[model samples]
Target: MLVLNSGSSSVKYQLLDMADGRRLAGGLAERIGESGGGGRIVHTSGDGGRRERTLPFPDHAAALGAVGEELRADGLGLDSPGLAAVGHRVVHGGTRFTEPTLVTDEVLEEVRALTPLAPLHNPANVTGIETARALRPDLPQVAVFDTAFHATLPEAAARYAVDRAVADRFSVRRYGFHGTSHQYVSRAAAGLLGREPSEVNVIVLHLGNGASASAVAGGVCVETSMGMTPLEGLVMGTRSGDLDPAVVFHLSRVGGLTMDEVDDLLNRRSGLVGLCGDNDMREIVRRREEGDREAAVAFDVYVHRLRKYIGAYTAVLGRVDALVFTAGVGENSAPVRAAATAGLEGLGITVDPELNAGRGGGARLVSPPGARVPVAVVPTDEEFEIARQAFALVGRSPR
Candidate 1:
C-alpha cells in the first residue's frame, strides 16, 4: 500500500510492503507550484544509504510523478504487485464522510464540495488523488479524512453558539483537525498502558508545525482544540491559535483591515513568529537561555495555552488516565513537557525531571514513580496509520 499524505505545499508518500509489514520506501516533495520551487525525494531501504535527488516540481501532479520516478530509481516503482492501495490525507470531510472512504466519483465530488470548508487543503488533496488515479487507473484510492476521527464528538461540543439557521447554512461548527494522528497515538497509548481503548481517558497534544489538543474519553473523541479549521488551537509555528473572535471585529473596525488581511495576519504572521520572530522551539529555547525576554514570553504563552487546555479537558473528562504528547515539539521538547505540566501534580499529571530530561524514546512514560496518572511521549505516525486503514479497507474488498 502507498499512503500519500499530500499537504498544500508538499507531498509525502510511503510505499508499504505489507507482506512483511515493512515500509519499503518513502519520500517527500516540498514547495510545490511555487517560483524557485524545488524539492528532494529520498528513498531508503532498511539499513542502507538513502537515494536522494533535488529537482524542480511545478505542481502536485508533477511532484507525484517525481516521486514515482524516484521509486523507479530504486527499482521499486508503483508497478510492484505488493502495491495494494493508495490512501490520501484529506483535511476536511465536513459533516459527512465519518469513516475512511473508497474514492468513487461521488465521493470525489463530495470532497470537492467540502473544499470551501478547507479551501487551502482539500483542493490539493483532491488533485493528488486524481493524479495518482491517472497514473495507476487500476489501483484503488482511499481518502482518509483528517476530520473522520473527530466525528465522534458530541453535538454540544461540535456546535457553535451562533444562530442555528445561519450556522447550519454555512456549516459553521467544530470540525477538529489532526484526527488521524490523534486516533493513531491514542490507540498506541492505550496499547502501551495495557488497557482496552474503551477504558482509557486521554489528552492528546499534537504539537508540530500545526498544533491541536484532543480529549479522548473512553477511547472516543469527546472534544478537540481546532474548531472548523487548523487555526483555532495551540500557539503554533506560524498560526495564532485560539484568539478572541472580536479580534476580527477590532481589526476590521479599528485597524481598517479586510477579512483576508486579518486571516493572513493571524494564520501566517502571528504566533511565535509574531511574538519572538522564531517558530522552532529549539531556537526559541536557545534565545530564551540567552536572556531574550521576547523569546521567553513567547515560550511562556505557548505553554500557558497548552496548560489551560489540559486543565479544561481534564475537567471535561472528569478523570484523565493518561496525558500523551506526540509530534515534533511534543516528542522532542522535554523542557516543554516539564513546563506545561508544572504545578499540575494535583491533577495526577507529573513529569519526572530525570526521566523526562534524560535519554530514551519509543512511547515511554515520563511520570514519576507510582504517579496516579502516566504522562507519555508517543511519536505520531500518521502515514503508517493511513496505510493501515487503507490496507484494511482493501483487504475487506480487495482490488
Candidate 2:
C-alpha cells in the first residue's frame, strides 16, 4: 500500500510492499505551486539511494504527476499490480468519521463540507486525493483522518461552554489535532512497556513546527492540548497556541488592526518565532548559548507552558505510566525534554540525562532507572499508521 501525506505546501508519499514488509519507494514534493513554481522530490529505494529533482510544479496535481513519474522511473509505478490502495493523511474529520474511510464521491463531498473547520488543511488534502484519483482511477483511495482517533473523547472533554444552540449552529467544540501521531506513538509506547494498551496511561507530546499534547488512558485519548483547530494548542513555528478570545476584539478595536490582520497575527506571525524572532529549535538553542536573553526567555516560556500541561494532564489521568515524546523537537531536542519534565519529581516524572540523549530506532524508554514513571522517546509514524488503517478499511488487509 502507498500512503500519501499531503500538507498545505507538500505531498509526502511512501510505497510499502506489505507482503515483504519492505519500503519499495518514498519521496516528497516540497514548496508546491509557489511563486516560480520551484519544488523538488527526493525518491529513495530499499538500499537508501536517493534520486532528487528540482523543477516547476505549478500545483498539487502537477506535483502528483511528478511523483508518478518518479515511481515509474523506479519501476514501482501505478501500473504495478501489487499496489493495493492509496492512503491520504487528512487533517480533520470533525465528528463524522471515527475510522479511516474508503474515499468515494460522497466521502469526498463529506470531507469538503468539513473544510471550514480546517481552512488551511482540508482543501489541500482534498486536492491531493482528487489529483491522485485522476492519476489512478481504478485504485482504491482511503482517507485517514488526523482527528478521527480523538473522536473517542467524551462530552466533558470535547464540549465548549457556550450556548448549545449557538455552538451547534457553528459546530464549535474541541476537536483535537494530531490524533494520528498521538494514537500511533501512544500505542507504540504501550508496547515498549509490555503492558496492554488499556492498562497504560500515557501523555504524548508531538512537538514539531506544529505541536500538541495528548493524554491517552489505556490507549484511548481522554484529553489533548489542541482544540477546535491546530491553532489552539502549544506554541508552534508561527501560530500562537492559546490566547484570550478578547485579544482579537482588542486588536481590532484599539490597535487599528483588522480582523484579517489579527487572524494573520495569530496564525502566521506569532508563537516562538514571533516572541523571540526564531522558530527552529536548533537556532533557538544556538541563540541561547550565545547569551541572547530573548531566545532564553522564549525557551523558558515554551517549556513553562509544556510543564503546566504535563501537570494538568497528569492530574486528569490520576496516574501516568509513561510520558512519550515524538515529532521533530520531541524526538530530537534533549534540552526541551529535560526542561519540560524538570521539577515534576513529585509526580514521578524524571528524565535521565544519559538515557534521554541516547538514540535508537523506533520506541525506547528514556526515563532514569528507578523512576516511578517512564519517560520515552517514541518516533511517531503517522504515515505508517494511516496506511495501516486505510488498507484495513479498503479490505486490502484483513482487520
Task: Give per-model TM-scores.
Answer: 0.96, 0.96
* Clashing pairs for predicted structure model 1, backbone only: none
Candidate 2 local lDDT, 113-180, one digit each (tens): 99999988899899999998998899999999999888888899999899999988998999898888
- lDDT per model vs. reference: 0.89, 0.89
Worst 10 residues of 1 by lDDT: 40-49
Native-vs-model 1 lDDT?
0.89
Q: Which residue runs does candidate 2 get wrong by more than 4 Å? A: 35-37, 396-399
Q: After superposition, how far is residue 313 of candidate 2 from its true place, in Å?
A: 0.8
Q: Write the per-residue lDDT of candidate 1 for residues 1-399, one digit (tens) a residue.
A: 888988877888888766655767787788887788566666665445587777778878788888888787777888877578899999999989888889999999999999889998999899999889998989999999899899999999999999999999999999999999999999999998999889999999999989999999877999999998889989999899998999999999999999999999999999999999999999999999999999999999999999999999999999899999999999999989999999898898999998898656688999997889899999898988888888888774322
